[model samples]
Target: MEDFVYFFSFQDPNVAMVVAGITLLSISAAMVGTFTFLDKKALLGDAISHAVLPGVCLAFMFAGSKNPYWIVLGAFITGAISTYAIEWISNSTKLKEDTVIAAVLSVFFGIGILLLTQLQQTGDAALSGLDHFLFGNAISIVYEDLMVYGILALLVIICILVFYKEFKLIIFNPSFAESVGLPVKRLKLLFNTLLVMAVVTGIQAIGVVLMAALLITPPAAARFWSNRLHVILMLAVLFAVLSGIAGAFISFAVPHMPTGPWVVMAISFIAFASFFFAGKKGILSKWYNQRNYQQKIHRDHILKSLFQALEKNSKTLEKDEIMEYFPGKEKLTRTYISKLEQENKIELEGEKLKLTPSGLVEAKRVVRLHRLWELYLAQYLNLAPDHVHDMAEKMEHLLTPELEAKLDASLDYPTQDPHHSKIPRDNDL
Candidate 1:
């Protein structure tokens, strides 16, 4: 607790700059990342990230120092080249896009590693921090670094907002956008430029290797929480900002924890947590809904059983006699009957279990649907009468009242099913 307080206390100006810079960088990455994700361009993003390593090394060697401007410029040039190379290779050949991306990523990254190794051997004092672009050192973001990355980040955000409609249309349905006379090709170019910019801005804070995570994880996480594009974008940005801050704090509070992996871990934790607990689409909600549906099926089956017995004898049975129909599940049947009684759907008068008026109506409806479907299948599809019962048993629980009416009309309100079983009517129960 105390460490957290001190971490954000802004008592040191450098910590304050890192936080603000990372926040801006995260927003840019998240916005671009959201678009890239929707367009299924994650591999392209990965390629750009790894490809920037050679640019970073070249910038340091050429500038003879760790100048932020030169490094960012060099990284942008190389990243853009890698992005174009993937597109060119894929377009000019029969090779798949994923394969082209993989090839380009390996080639560029391998060359960058070679250059970085050579530079390290030269023993230049200024090259000591060049490897910071590999795993990231968020604490190293100075005011000058913030000014450069922050402005680039802001430019990305503004471009996205200005061309929101064009970007969205291009990503979701480029052919449609083209048919509608929109400048589909231009929009894609602008989007790709912004994507490269997003990668470059993060090379200092998120690093080259893990930049892809910084770009995609937030959007992937937010997808579980929202269905709308704008809402998802906002949620993604929020998640990214939170993760960036959390990662910085851990690295700042502890001695040697790298910020990039911790940031990925934090956002990944948020994504998994959302996957398990989101209201409509999560694991817990799915389990809860399935359990409710099972209980409903149990209730419907009990009601139908009681109605069938009454049809035969015109009288209710004792609780033990009702158990005769359930076989081996007598204990479960008692629990179900007791619950039905509590819900006022059934009553225990003396020793006899009887359906209430509400129960009778529902039971008649269930039985009617079952009999009607069985008749339709056997009469229309020519299935044997005995073979239809097993299927009707399942379909009876699925037919909505509207569908039941349609079935009745189609069968012309048949009095009996193919097996000569009485199809219970509205007034009979």
Candidate 2:
């Protein structure tokens, strides 16, 4: 508890600096990553992240230490080169983008690993914390590191905000952007530069290996909760900030844990939760909605069956006769019956069941919709009456009142379906 309080209090200058740097990096990475994700260039971020490792190694060897300026410059140059390589290889060959990204990632990362191994063999004293870049040590972010990374992060964020519309156009509709006299190629190049810079800023705090997760996961999780681009960006930033701070706090409390893995873990958890529990798009929500839809269909089927029987001069049905309609689904049928009774849509007098007035009104609408659709299919689509029944059965429960009206108008408000049965109207009920 004390550790939590002290860590977040920003009371210490070092803690305050770490939080500021990480917050800036998170904002920039999330903003860039949201567009990258929408454009389906996620693997490109992964490739660029791994490709920057060799640059980190080369910078360390040349400078004899981890100078933030040298590291950022080298990392940005190599990351940009990797981005170009991916684009060139993809456009020049028959290879897919993922294949090109995978190849570049493997080759550049392999060279980086080899160079890093050689640097370690040299036994340079300045190499004390060099390995921290692989899996980040956010605790090691000094003033110099913060200055370089923070400034670059701010630049990336500002550019994203300034060119938001252009970026959106290029990402979602590049051909349209070009048609409107927008420099699609230049905007793409600029966005790619900012992408590399965003990844470069995180190489120290979030690490090369796990930085892609920090870039991609927040936006992915945010997407489940929103459809608007701006709202998604804001949510992604919120998620990134939470996970980034949680990772930093874990690093502060733990003896030697890397902040990058923890940050990835935190963000991944958010993604997993979003996948299962987010509204409208989540697994649980979808299941609930599907269940409700199925139940409504079943209830409609029962009501329709009762109404059809009433039309044939049988006002009520024995409960056993109704169960016979749903062979193996007696229990579920009973549940639906109970629900309808509760809603006053149906009445159960002893073992006999019949629709109430409100239920008859609903039943008439359902039957009308089914017959209307069947007539529409038979007349306009030239489908046989037999073929239309099955399709109408599925679509009967899905049409809204407005759609039903439109369908009726399109069909000229017919009185009979393709089968020549009278389509029940409200007066008939």
Candidate 3:
């Protein structure tokens, strides 16, 4: 806790700058990443990250030092080349996408390693930090490197802001976008270029190997929390910024530690939390909803059975009679009856269970929906009346009033189903 407070205290301008720089970079990367993740082009980021290594080595070789501008230029060139090559190979040949990605990643990384080894043998002190780009050393980022990253991040943000609608259309339906006369092909190339640039800019601080996580995981995690594009983008940026700050602080507290892996770890933690806890789409939410839905269905079924027994025997059923109807589910039946009593849907009189007037109306509606659906299926879908009952039995709880009305109109307001059972009127008791 003290370490965290000390890290963010901003007493040291260097620490403050590093934290701010990492936050900006992470936000930009995660924003771009959300789109790539939605479009299912995450592997492309990995490919570009590895492909930029040779360019980094080449830039170092030419400049004989760690010049940010030269390195970025070199990285962008190789990154673009790798992206284009993958597209070219995928389009021109029968190779699968995974195969193409593997080929490009291995070849480019191998070449980069060779160039790095050559540079290492030359014993140049200025080139000392160049190798860190491979695995990353975020603690070593100087103010100049941060400035370069800041500019690149700004450019990425600008591109995303200006092209937001175009990107959204392309991602959801490229064919539809093209039909509307949008430049689908050029826009795809542009998106790929931006992805490459995002990867290239992170090479120094996040490293090639782990940079892919920054580009993919936050956005992927954010998706579990929102379905809307704008919401997903916002959440992705938030998660990324938090991860970046945490990772930067950890590195600051522990001298010489690489920032990339810790950032990836922090992002993974956020992702895990989102997966299990986020509302609507999260695992826990889905589980709760499923359980509630099952309980509702069970209650509806019990009410339905009580109605059926009353219809046959007149007005009420003994507790033992109801239990006998659902022998295997007797425990469930008893529990649901208790719940219904609590809800005031049913009441007990001596040894018998009776539906209140309100309960009778709801039970009647369920029965009507079931019989109406069964009739509709028999007449339209040509299913046997007996076969339709089982399906209608399950669908009764799901039918909306609008759907029931539609079914009623389609069936021409049939008074009786194929089974000769009277379909209860809306005002029926």
Candidate 4:
């Protein structure tokens, strides 16, 4: 508890810097990731992240020390090169983009490993934490490192804000953006630069190996909660912040625990939770809605059958006879009959069932929608009356009263369907 308080209170200057740097990095990564995710450039982000390791090694080789400025500059340069290489190779060759990205990722990362191994052989004291870049060490963030990474992250956030509309246009509708005189190619270059910067910002705190998670996971998870771009961006930022702080806290509390994997784990938990529980799009909600809808369709079928029997001058039907309509679903049909009885939509007398007044109205509406659609298909779509029943059966439970009215008006309020049977309406009651 004392550790938790001390960590969060930011009482130590170093702790404060780590927290601030991580938060800013999270925000930038999430914002860029939102567009990157929407544009489906996730694989490219992964490739650039792995490709930056060589640049980190080259920067260390040139600077003779672990200077954050040299490291970030080198990392950004190589990351950009990797991005262009993937684009160029894919466009110029018969190879697909994914194949090019894979090759670039493997070659760059392999070179980085070779360079890093050589640097380690020199036995330099400064090389002590150099390998931390592969995983990450949030605890090692000093003031100098914070300054460089924070500034890069802030720049990414600012550019995204300033060019929000252009980015959106280019991502969602590049042809339209080009038609409007937006520099689609230059904007893409600029965005790619920002993507590299975002990755670079996290390379120290989240590590190159896990940096793509910082870039991609938050926005991917946020999408399950919202469809609005701004809302999704906000949610992504919130999720990233939570995961980043949790990772930082865990690293502070546990000895020798790398922050990167913990952060990835935290974000993964949030994502899985969103997948199973988000309101409209989640698995549980979708399943519940589908079950209810299927039940409603079944209930409508039962009512329609009863009404049709009444039309034939039979006021009631034996329960077994109605169950015959659902050959393999006798149990489910019986359940619906009981539910209708409980709702006062139908009544049972001995072995026979008949619709109540409320049930009759509901049944008439369903039947009317079915016949009206059949007539609409016959008169306008040129479908034969015999060919329209199947389509109408599926659409009957989906039509709204407003749509029914529209169909009636368009069909000139026909009294009979193409089958020459009465198209029952409220007036007919």
Off by over 4 Å in 3: 121-123
**By TM-score, is 1 or 2 better?**
2
Predictions in order: lDDT: 0.89, 0.94, 0.87, 0.94
Tell me the TM-score of model 2.
0.99
What TM-score does structure 3 among the candidates reach? 0.94
lDDT of 2: 0.94
* Tens-digit lDDT string for candidate 3 (243-362): 888888888888778888888999999999999988988899999999998888888877887888777866888889888877798888899999999989999998888998888888
Residues 273-387, candidate 2, lDDT per residue (tens digit)? 9999999999999999999999989999999889888988998998899988899999999999999999999998899999999999999999999999999999989998899
Q: What is the TM-score of candidate 4?
A: 0.97
Which model scores highest in TM-score?
A: 2
Q: Compared with the true structure, what per-residue lDDT tens digits does model 1 show for residues 123-148?
A: 88878778878988798889899999
Tens digit of per-residue lDDT, candidate 4, span 1-429: 999999999889999999999999999999999999999999899999999999999999999899999999999999999999999999999998888988999999999999999999999998988998998889889999999999999999999999999999999999999999999999999999999999999998999999999889999999999999999999999999999989988999998888899999999999999998998898998999999999999999999999899889998999988988889999999999999999999999999999999999999999899899899999999999899999999999998889889988999998888899899987565
- Candidate 4 local Cα displacement, residue 51, angstroms: 0.8
Clashing pairs in 3: none
TM-scores of the models, in the order given: 0.88, 0.99, 0.94, 0.97
Order of candidates by TM-score, top first? 2, 4, 3, 1
- Enumerate residue pairs that collide in model 4: none
Clashing residue pairs in candidate 1 (N, C-alpha, C atoms within 3 angstroms) = none
